[model samples]
Target: MKIKGLKQLSRTLEKAGQSGFRTEAAKWLEQTGTDFLDLVRDEIVRAGSIDTGSLLRSFKRGAEGNIWEIEKGGLTLEVGTELEYASFVNDGHWTGGKEEVRWIPGQWHSGRFQYDPGSSSGMVLKRQWVKGTGYWEHAFYIFERLFEKRLNERLQTWLNSL
Candidate 1:
């Protein structure tokens, strides 16, 4: 994920320095939030898949100035997407939730045109039972695993930089 508006973040940190405790807290939170997003994006790309690029692109950091204010970052670090189908890519269908059954109406045209036996033309009702196996391919979970392995080294580097 490409994080935008760091020039503004610098100004935010400066303002936070002047505002005392609350702003200082905001500054720390913003840093951690942005870093976490970057880490997730890196992990997603490294994991690599057909939809991984789009998924990485979907991860966004709040605008820099907004990072220090309640309207955007501050206590509200928003790092997600407007992409409607993100859930489908993250979690394979029917795997994220419990099993379900859907009842579909019987129709003549649907039966004759769509099926070979055309046995569904009967007036009797039909139910489709969807069994969910919990086939989880969620990239974030992979990222979590990678982060766990690297956490100590990553934290050590960041602390040394400070």
Candidate 2:
């Protein structure tokens, strides 16, 4: 008995391994990043966290003046946000002094909190904590599962083509 088509198989494998595989993988990774960003924006909207649409717009591609950044390279993907208040919105925070009662210089308009130092209207509270909306956290939780499933499907399709 003799083995046949080994040469063709080897050549195909080599070609795939050189650059084709990397290019395909990078494409899928970039797509996944885009999908993840859309998912996060949808989650923010679903959670009713849109105030001025700043956070929603921040989750996008590119680097200049954007809070969120999505970078893709050879078989690597990176997703992050530069907004400092994002964590606070997702994790919650205290309103004023936790140890002592303090006067908070802010005003409530139509059930929304607005910080105004010059405004005469204000509120006093102690150890008051605002619950986190968990929009980002929820989006991440959802995107984790989605990314795994999508990556597997994409890889399977690529491999089948090979």
Candidate 3:
């Protein structure tokens, strides 16, 4: 929420080298997101308070980034690669919704999502508004490596912890 001690953590991560940062981010993903999918599914099937036809909210992770959504609504969450490159798309699908992208400078000032893998990662979601078709985009990304893919690979680690 407050990102409590983010400044301190970031400093320490940078000092320890890129691998340390990845390990830390991966840990965050494992602790927060892994079971969210299952929990939502359970709520839909049993609570009956959620729409079951399609996910009311969905999450996607890759080596480049991560995304969060609420079907037919607005963007809810996002996390991008290690370079701070982000594309947070909220509301509807990209068809008409807007996206917020965060840009991070990587090793040699590169913006590649997976070339280095040691410099960047995060996400953002853009939301849409009814007035004048306005859209709100939230973004957090790192442009160093293919973060989304890495996120996917590490899912099992999260599951194991669960």
Candidate 4:
């Protein structure tokens, strides 16, 4: 498995025993709150007879990112959520924290995650967008950015009491 930030959030999230913001975020993202976490959670798509690259491009990544081949039929998605990243427990919750693109405890940390499903192998590719900080919650980072622009406009109008 590939592990990014071997010393920080990466390690924390992987731990079966929870701790800190990483653990909290996981719980929050799974079964609580408001934001659509499922859309941003780590994803693993089996080849499923479809062309993996084409399938990801069309249905998953939109138009960017590349695919890494693992085994005969296993393929890895450059983007997607790990189940632990955001458990089904909390699907629509707000991942609260400071810093944009930070490694919050509950959310999945950002990095260059790689998966080799054939061998049941995967690793966090978390290279922080910010400097100095180690691994941060990744799922939250993806959650905020993916939906922030849309939410802001809606919230502004709703809060106006129109």
Candidate that scores best on TM-score:
2
**What's the lDDT of the predicted structure labeled candidate 3?**
0.38
- Using all chains and alpha carbons, the TM-scores for the candidates as numbered come to 0.39, 0.70, 0.24, 0.21
Alpha-carbon shift of residue 94 in model 4 (angstroms): 32
Among all windows of ten consecutive residues in candidate 1, which has the lowest summed lDDT?
Answer: 63-72
> Candidate 1 clashing pairs?
none
TM-score order of candidates, top first: 2, 1, 3, 4
lDDT of 3 at 82: 30
Assess the local accuracy of residue 155 in candidate 4 as a C-alpha lDDT between 0 and 100.
42
Candidate 1 residue lDDT tens string, 7-117 = 776766565556554544455556655655566566556545335355565554543222222333346645555556554544434423244443334455734633334
Clashes of 4: 35
> How many clashes show up per model?
0, 0, 48, 35
What is the C-alpha lDDT profile of model 3 across 1-162, one tens digit per residue?
588878976765466564344455545555444445344334334424333333323323442233432222232334322322112212323423356544443444355333344556433334534221111121112211334666666654543343
Clashes of 2: 0
Sort the candidates on lDDT, descending order.
2, 1, 3, 4
Write down the worst ten-residue block by lDDT for model 2. 63-72
Q: Kindly list the per-residue Cα lDDT of model 2 for residues 59-88, writing each as its tens digit.
A: 777743354333444355666567776667
* Cα error of candidate 4 at position 70, Å: 39
How far residue 55's Cα lies from its native spot in candidate 1, in Å, is 2.2
Q: Whole-model lDDT, candidate 2?
A: 0.75
Alpha carbon lDDT at 15, candidate 1: 55
